[model samples]
Target: MTNHWLFWGFWVMANALASFMWGSIVLSATPAAFAGMLLGIVVFILVYGTLDAYLIKQNLSRWHDALRRSVYIKAGLQLMNVFLAFGWPASPELWAGIISVGITQDRLGIAQNHYPFGFALLNTLLTGAILSLMVAALTAIIFFIRKKHESR
Candidate 1:
């Protein structure tokens, strides 16, 4: 439980930073706003999802030598999912689909458009940040529980 909390905290902070960065880019564009937003999402997927996947796999492999095979397989599947979702075009429908899937997995809520320029930007940032935090929290809880059971 302690470990889960720690992991969740870290994830929330990371996601907050990521959201702010992406939201700023998305909201600052004059024309081609959608395109810019897409670009930002792509960058985020590449940097956060892919790179984090690698790091996660490495850590898991090191932590549980006997469970490496299964852990690696699961991580691979997650990476694939992230890649697929990231490659898809960014639209309200697409986001809705992603949010639905995430909700089914107990991840995060849907992203909605906000009012006013500043408010919209803040909301966008919060949406991403909160979702990322949820993912991290869930992942940490699962891993911690598994580790506890294994140890017992």
Candidate 2:
């Protein structure tokens, strides 16, 4: 907390590592889904980092509170992503948002031979949901440990 840069540095590094790992798993399935990988990392850092900061500033009064809120947000986003991927034609604007980040539908479409849209959608959603839960649990454990240490 005393060193702000250190906190941000660690945060960015951790986020990047998670993004790449997820990217790798995604690529393994689709192979030609490079655009998705890039979009996932960039959007995650920009969107999630900004939202997390704002939530901490406005709603979260403590570190643990922010982490808890983040868990909910991440889980919700994964569900939303699933819906966006599956119901892309219904809510077409979702593609715009994703494309704005540089991942075109054509790129995703190219992998249809190996990974159909539905298959990719389900795989991404399932993996993201599981990872989000794991991260949330880890955050909760860290929060409790820090609280306990401070209390003692």
Candidate 3:
């Protein structure tokens, strides 16, 4: 991360690849260059925004240990989604394999099926963002209440 060349190279390569993939998805599904680029930008922003927030939170944890617990709680709850997808699964390894393939198909293997990748990806991205925002707001509310109670 300290190496400037390496850092910028990562972003440049990522955006270029994203642009090409999104452009292809857009052109094939809807034939709109403008929409494809916009979609790329939107996807980039959503992903980097989350990453930046995560990085900042990690940096803050250098002094504030509670932040680490909150992150663990957040992640544990997030991990529940995959396990819950199986509804009390008895086998962890089987569930992990099934979830990996399911996610892979959701992202890449939609051509043979009726659901195209573009619309499905866009729908899921927006839905996930909305749900994430709601979770952040709720966490903030709980944090404020805890701070208030601790100050008493």
Candidate 4:
């Protein structure tokens, strides 16, 4: 915790790595979708693993400040997933993001084999938001679990 570089560096790395790999990790549809969702949760945990540790280390009366800071870090990290559209190997599977929401199609017309910048950007934002909410819930759950354990 004393080493600022180490803390922030790992935090970024973990989130980036998760975002970079999240889309590609989903295998298929139907019954397998459940497994894929489970895998997605795993990725969220990977992103949040260090964050939870870092927040626990801070031991402040209010964890909201740390949560806010982490969401910003996550959003920034999501930007790197732009490569997803170029078939960078991590493109999100959400091929139908609403254009009005600033997300274009996963790619242009078939045979074109290209992805809109907005597609990746929207996926990035959506996932980042989901991750923030999920991790916040996780943080709370973890806090209560820890409190209960400590009381014992």
**TM-score: which is higher, 1 or 4?**
4
Q: Residue by residue across 9-99, what tens digits does model 3's lDDT show?
A: 3442343342244335433454343453455445644464455456566775322333333433433443443564568653322333344
TM per model? 0.36, 0.43, 0.36, 0.39
Q: How high is the CA lDDT of each candidate model? A: 0.42, 0.46, 0.44, 0.46
Candidate order, TM-score descending = 2, 4, 1, 3
The sequence of per-residue lDDT tens digits that candidate 4 reaches over residues 132-152 is: 664466556665666677799
Estimate the overall C-alpha local distance difference test score of candidate 4.
0.46
Residue 3, model 2: lDDT of: 49
Over 58-93, each residue of candidate 1 has an lDDT whose tens digit, in order, gives: 775433332233323323333333444567543332
Which portions of model 2 show Cα errors greater than 4 Å? Answer: 1-32, 59-61, 64-126
Model 3 TM:
0.36
User: Under the 3 Å rule for N, CA and C atoms, how many clashes does model 4 have?
Assistant: 0
Report the C-alpha lDDT of model 2 over 99-124, residue by residue, as the tens digit: 42233235434343455444334333
> TM-score of predicted model 2?
0.43
Report lDDT (Cα) of residue 67, candidate 3.
Answer: 33
lDDT of 3: 0.44
Best candidate according to TM-score: 2
